[model samples]
Target: MQTSNDIRTPAEIYDELFVPALFQQWAAVVLDAAKINPSSKVLDVACGTGVLALAAAGRVGTGGKVSALDASPEMLGVARRKSVRIEWHEGVAESLPFEDNTFDAVVSQFGIMFFRDRIAALKEMMRVLRRGGSLAVAVCDSLDHSPGYSTFAKLLERLFGTPVADAFRAPFVLGNPETLLSLCNDAGIENAQVRQHSGQVRFASIASLVSTERACAWTLGGMLDDQQFEELSREAELALQPFAGENGDIAFEMPALIITAHRP
Candidate 1:
């Protein structure tokens, strides 16, 4: 599924569907962990569709500066549509565009796992942050611990192959606390603190989950053939049946780590 590395869909789907489904749960947590102030200059690294960045902008008010960066122009375009006050840049996290000590805080949610050079990105983030400024990053726990994604990946593996299944598992690769701490130490950021956090992911129905993945999950969607898709869909429905709620909503607990530290 790495072959689909550059795949992209309408960015609206991400802001509308994916954000509400998962990322919104941790948006406030990122700001709270970072302890950002109204007048602080902030940078949101890899700010896909500007959820965290927008949230930060709200906190910063007119006195503060909020800048968001992502490698994808498509994502940035969607983010730009939402707010004109927040500065949006198109760039990779490994090499930030601004000079050193530019931002009072740096935050990212579920973005670090995909960085090509994790330590380089962390170092860049630290370099941009002022002394005593905080860093807050959230990485999803392993799929084995995430019932919804784990079950979907297993179904994909059974239906097609391990490559696709492994692709589903990629986001959770850096979930371990040791990895988070190690990244900080390697980046030369001091006094790192990693916190384990659990949040409930609620979907209106299993169909909500399925439809979002089918359209926007770059690693999994548009790979299967006609017959294969039918088989996968049927199996997925069966797999989700046990998790359905009284109102047909599907809710599952997702484990994640919020790594916070300050530049010193």
Candidate 2:
């Protein structure tokens, strides 16, 4: 509990901050689409802090098996502390450390976009899934679909220039359904069904959003000094006011694409 040099990893920060703000709401949707059942054996790929893994584990219950895989040891460490029953493996998505035709369902939530080689990862997901086993994945939609993030990106580009702020664009790079389906085809995964899903973005206020960004958003946070950040927050508030309610609550719609397929 006491540490001077124990730096918090991105996985730790993601589990504590972004999970509630974003990932938790989508985990069930992903697992449900994968059709995880009490007797199913499940695997969550790129399972940052194991949100989807935990949800699948609950659905699978005592009779089922659940394994969580991530490229980050830090992330796996965080996941292990939360659940010991499920197996945790540190590995990349492109080359899963598992045997072929082993899982009933393989699921990933908001993690497909970050894979270094999405096509290879897709193949690996298929490789590990048994015949007729399902694969379900969710990825954030384009920037325009998320008002708060769009405004923040506008601000980021203004402050840091387009090239740097473009890093923020990575998550939405595969937002298109056509692109998703095409990638699966190229990867030799067949009959993938791609569909859009809408969800809500919620924060107590614009200030709360700004504060969270400052504290945890690595890409754009800490680049500006205190005074500049405060000014940026003020500007962001004005820009986001249309979505703010009378009680000053911030809420907006966010879209994502969910892709599902089964092995031949």
Candidate 3:
């Protein structure tokens, strides 16, 4: 249960690994649930690198505004560079800076799971959203469903024991729909619809995957120390030996979830 602030440098964490593929898959799903309109003022909470915010900007167009907020200044910086129109704010999800009922819709992707006070963050999201406004959030389904990472996890557990595996489990808190739905209810969001999605996780090589993990030190990178890190990296490379192809590319499928809710 690490707070976003506990991870001091998100820019370093996200430089290599990003939500690009995941975002592309879920953005449409989120937008569909959000029911975006040209006149809708959107708030993207914990908007990392502005994937949803940028997509929201496209949906809102010139008539509306997109206010993207994240605790990580580095993330906000990257998001800012992509689109000047998006009003990027350095803030946390637990306490939003905007006025009450400021947004026509509020959306988050893989963000709510990281909140230290989940209820407070959701309440804030609900508070800022206008009555009848929509809330769409996407979270990782479960570790079992994510084979690319699941296999890696099993291997890591075999090597490092359960403690390390438990640390990795935090990011997949909402993997279960029942738990996620209960959390939504706790936050006062009703009538939530959970949708299932899957995407391909591609790596140019085993080395590429390891590099990406090092670059994005959020979860995978954070768990390992210098010795453990090198050991795991070498193990991963060895594990991928069977999958290595003529071009040395390896790809796998990872499961994802798109959980959407609305204010009653």
Candidate 4:
């Protein structure tokens, strides 16, 4: 099973390392919020490696249909290899390639913060949703809401300055409920509900936690040089000790704001 020719891309590393630790657990939560039925036509926007889409396909069974779209072809490549039943598309969130009133449920997880036009993306999600169909979106809660990451951010600042710390903090930019609700309103989405759902950020070790973020483009990828990465790793081993278990596993509460709405 081991070979010198085996080279895993960054997307593959993301799917392999990040999905199970951070994202896979949220699939059911998203599907539940969207009320995925056995025959429901579901669309997963910014589907990443298709964790949510794979789960949706399972829920829909043979009669239902599940389609996933992401901006990354590399990610879509990994997702396609995992399952052949679900439809996979490579596209941006703001301009979804689907007909209006086509989907019974639309869901996105932790992808809204990075969208070029968040309001346009939400509007597109709504536009493609049939009347009375459900939409669920999940985004990381603010850095302030997560003490572990708050500490980690400060550590990054100590080691690499504010820009690097800010890079680490980008995903939490949409953590504020008011800001997210305002986005919904701006997008003309009626009666959108935003609720904070507590979750855990776990890694095999402090090293795993730090290394994953190092490789993640969403976090600190391409920002740290080799020495800087080593410095951060050395610092993080102690800085993140509070959340580490006896087995050296890292665990902390990292809540997310889940926004749910229906097309009226």
lDDT per residue, candidate 4, 1-264, as tens digits? 432213667688789878988888898998998999998999999999999999999999998999999999989999999999999999999999999999999999999999999999999999999999999999999999888899999999998899999999999999999999999999998699999888888889988878788888778888998789889989999899999999889888888899999998
Error in Å for residue 245 of model 2: 3.2
Cand. 4 TM to true fold = 0.96
Give the winner by TM-score. Answer: 4
Model 4: colliding residue pairs: none
Query: For every model shown, what is its TM-score relative to the native structure?
Result: 0.93, 0.90, 0.87, 0.96
lDDT of 3 by residue, 1-264 (tens): 543424546563353344643455677678878888999999999898887898889988999999999998878877787888999999999999999888889998888878889888988988998888888888877888766667777777887888776666656778888887788789887777777777666667877666555445455656666678678778988776665567987677666676676666
In model 2, which residue pairs have backbone atoms overlapping below 3 Å?
none
Question: Poorest 10 consecutive residues of model 4 by lDDT?
Answer: 1-10
Looking at model 3, report the run of 10 residues with the lowest lDDT sum.
12-21
lDDT of each: 0.84, 0.84, 0.77, 0.91
Error of 1 at 68 (Å): 0.3
Order of models, best TM-score first: 4, 1, 2, 3
Pick out the ten consecutive residues of candidate 2 with the lowest summed lDDT.
1-10
Q: Which residue pairs in candidate 1 collide?
A: none
Candidate 4 Cα lDDT to native: 0.91
Query: Model 3 residue 75 lDDT?
Result: 85
